[model samples]
Target: MRALTGTGVLTRLALRRDRLRLPLWVVGLAALFASIGNSISGLYETDAARLENAQVRADNVVTRAFTGPAPGSSTGALTVSEGLVFTCVLVALMNILLVVRHTRQNEELGRTELVGSAAVGRHAQLTAALLVAGLANVLLIVLSTLALIGMGLPAGGSALAGLALGTVGLAFAGLTAVAAQLTESARAATGLGGLVLATTFLLRAAGDAFGNTASDDITVNPAWPSWISPLGWGQQLRPYGESRVWPLALLLLCSALSVLLAVRLSVHRDVGTGMLPARRGAVRASSAMLKPIGLVWRLQRGLVLGWMVGIAVFGAVFGGIGDQVDDLFSSEKSAQFVRDLGGEGDLVNAYFAGMMGLLAVVVSGFTVQALIRLRSDEENGPTEAVLATSVSRAHWLLAHTLIALLGTALVLAVLGLSTGLAYGAVSNDLTAALGDLLETTLAQLAPTAVLAGFALAAFGLLPRLAATVTWAAFAVCLVIGQFGTLLNLPDGLLDISPYSHLPNMPAESLTVMPIVVMVVLAGALTAVGVAGFRRRSLALGG
Candidate 1:
């Protein structure tokens, strides 16, 4: 009983800590979903048009792979098909980061030890973390439901859809709790949880993509693989089609069981340790640690390699889809939707341009994460030690920043090259496909640079607020660039994001002037950040 005695107190404390962070995530997700729903509603205004869209989706393997089957014949069903999986993914990520931040991350940072010195029980922290995650998911469900209902969707289906998203998040929250027990470091715990998420997501995608058609222009009956994953269970709910509620039971069961396992595992390990033994490192430091950039790379290479592989894989899959979707734009309404999301000119070209633009935003997430390493190193007490050597403050800061910049190019290049290869092979014209995609992806560099520079500015001028600023700025850019037009968000608010100036390539002709201006702005921001960081002490903010 004493083990959870402080859970109430800790829960409040956790809420206080995450007030800003969690609200931002919840609002952004719900608004983005609603914006997308509004766009889908506009795109398929007529019953005939909706029917045509459904038929196109049913025939499109790529759409099925990404979104699964439409749950029903209505616009709401179409919205669910388009947004539910993406919503699930974002919610799961939210829970994973939430739980891990309160549990393993706090432990690694020694906050747990300070708490344990008081009257808190062994299980109190984990319990509080899970409670906070549940509350966040609940908020998401309610806001999302209201958002759907506001768009004139049926209340019952809208609530069910929200429930599906929330339950998936809860299941992953519980899973991540177990992962926190299994790993010694926050990064390790997060990586373990991410592996599980990635595996299950792929299974769900494969199952849906390869499933049997339940009826023409309607649901796809997923295979057995879908039944094994929490995300898959969410998809099986058929909220707008069958309106089934039993699938939620599976997700709830998974969450309950995983939580029990985590609580049991808590008794077996000491605070700051893990159920899995930590691997011992070598006695001597590597020569790579001698230089700032090399040390930065050593810390960042795994993250870089992971993004590169993921972007490359997705690029190839979508490139193949791009080739197949050329005929899918015959309908004027479909062309209009594509233009709204993608760009103008040829529909297929617009699709490619849209994909590249989104990928660039995705890569900027990597950029923000990479830039925030400055805060992590400083917090973990390594920056002082490294800078104690000959490494100047600017040298240390720029080393990490340069890797983030260069790493962007490497990832973009991999995405371009892989997509080009796939598209060319499918289209039987390697030369032109390779050239166009390579150039299109390269054009994204200016936007990516602008984002990186912004994040770097956060690191420089606001040492204590780097991660928060970086992530917030990037999130704003992503939501605006991806969904602002669809939602009809004001041009002023939309233009505040760097990606607004990003040229949607191939669909719109290239302009050197905008590219050059973006480059100049990025350089100016980067210089400001480096100069500010140089002026401050290692212990400046705190």
Candidate 2:
């Protein structure tokens, strides 16, 4: 009871604080579902054509791996399944981020301390954060239901899909709450939650892929695996099939149990302490940690290594799928589409080029995150403390910035090398594929540099809103780079993404002009950021 007092008022405050952000999340999710529905309906308007396409797609291992089981016969069912699986995962991600942000992150920043001193109880804060996340899930359900129904899906099936998606979110919200209790730092909590989400997604992918195989006539019931993963349970609901709704009840039960566990953990631990004890570091600094640059490397090394490994894995998987793409495009219709999207050339090279572009986007995200870390450290007052020593502001900023740039490039190269190695193994053309991959990786440098420069400039000029501005820029770039073609956006609008200027590699000749221009822009932005940072007063902790 002491833990649950003043929950109502705190819940209201949380709601008010998240007014804009919550709505954006809900609307974005709704739009994603709606867009998917609309796209599917438009693509497969005829039942006969839809059935044929579904069968063909179901047999395609790559398609199956990406999008779970194809709907058996009905066009509507197929559309629903495709949208439900992807949207449910997206919703789960949203819930985890929201819950962790409001709970663990708030505590880490000392915001909870201010409220704790008031009439608010310990459990009240946790309860309020969970309530906020739960309410957002409810909104997600309602909006998704409306969007699906508006798409002309069966009312019951649509509602089931919405419930399933929301349930996945609720389940993860609980998981994040527990993680928040276990970890001392918000970063650790968020990272652990992300890892769980990734694991769930992989489990679901593997289950779905295994179940759909031809030799598996015994029907490897995906329901069992789906039960193993909260994400899997969402997919197992099979919205358009039987519309089983009890799985959602299971999710709710799991969520409640998780919340109870978190509460218990909270009660046991001291304020700002974690369930897992922190290990002490060595008393003396290592030789590698002596210099400022080395210190930066020490701080960022884990993240950099993680990103490299992840990108490399992605590259390998994508490369493995390349051969399958060639087989799929053997059909004239698919081949024509591929050619139109990625000029007439060796299909493998064209596909690889497009994949490399996506890799560049991911690498850009790394660059942005790395650059923004500097601003975060500065605003947190660590930068000021560091600068009070013998280090100059220019040296500190440049050291971090150079690391970001070089780190991103290294990640890109790793991706290229891993992908090339996999593709070469399949094609038995090691030299050519490796060369092509290296060239494509190099081509991405222009855009990566531009994004890094922009992030640094924002951090330097608008120290207060640097992180927000940088992320917003990255989001815009992501949209332009990914959805521009699908949305039929004009070239002028697409050109806003720096990557738009870099010619598609492996399929197109290398163009030095755009590369040179990007380099100049990067230099200019870096100079501006450095100048602004030099002039501005050093920021202190909030």
TM-score for candidate 2: 0.91
Pairs that collide in candidate 1 are none
* Clashes in predicted model 2: 0
TM-score of 1: 0.95
lDDT of each: 0.85, 0.78
Tens-digit lDDT track of model 2 for 1-542: 77688999989988898888789889889888877778666655565656666665567554555566654546456765567777876787788888878888888888888888888888988899899998999988999889889888788877887888788889999999999999988878887888888788777777776664344221124534556788777776767765677777778888999999999999998777789877678999889666678888877887798799778867876776676765545555545555544556888777777778877887888888888899778765368778989989888999898888879888988988988887888778888888888889878988888888888788788888887788888888877876687678999999999988877788898989999999999999998888888888877312
Name model 2 segments beyond 4 Å from true.
Answer: 44-49, 60-63, 80-85, 212-220, 223-226, 326-341, 344-347, 425-431, 540-542
Q: Candidate 2 clashing pairs?
A: none
- Give the Å shift of residue 321 in candidate 1: 2.1
List TM-scores for all candidates, in order: 0.95, 0.91
Q: Which consecutive 10 residues in model 2 have the weakest lDDT in total?
A: 212-221
lDDT of 1 at 525: 90
Model 1, residue 116: what's the lDDT?
A: 96
